[model samples]
Target: MTTQYGTWRKSRLSEANGACVEVARSLRGTIGLRDSKAADSGPILELTRREWTMFLRSIRAADKIG
Candidate 1:
């Protein structure tokens, strides 16, 4: 099925260097992730909303613990 994703946004913390990721949400509520530099030409990683939430929670929890 074709998915229509929202506008991709880079992290505010992203540096000027070419090492950043962009994220967008699909109408199906899934998240789309791609390399900022490559953009549409790059492969996208798709994840469900729950998976994305869990991933963010893990990162934040790791930050707190470390």
Candidate 2:
């Protein structure tokens, strides 16, 4: 079966300098994410729903963490 990659959306925290990450949805139940700079060269990280939530939590707590 062919895999379909959905449109990529930039993060709301992105700046005007274009330094941000793009995320896309794959045909499977995985989320695809890549760097905005080296899109094609950068490796994509596919994460499940649970993993994604955990990642979000980590990012939210980044500032609180030492």
* Tens-place lDDT digits, model 1, residues 9-46: 99877878778989999998999988998996888899
TM agreement with the true structure for every prediction: 0.85, 0.80
Model 1 quality (TM-score): 0.85
lDDT of 2 by residue, 1-66 (tens): 544568989998888998998988887877887888888777788888789889989988996896
Q: What overall lDDT, based on C-alpha atoms, would model 1 receive against the true structure?
A: 0.90
Give the poorly placed runs of model 1, Cα more than 4 Å off. Answer: none
Question: Lowest lDDT 10-mer window, candidate 1?
Answer: 11-20
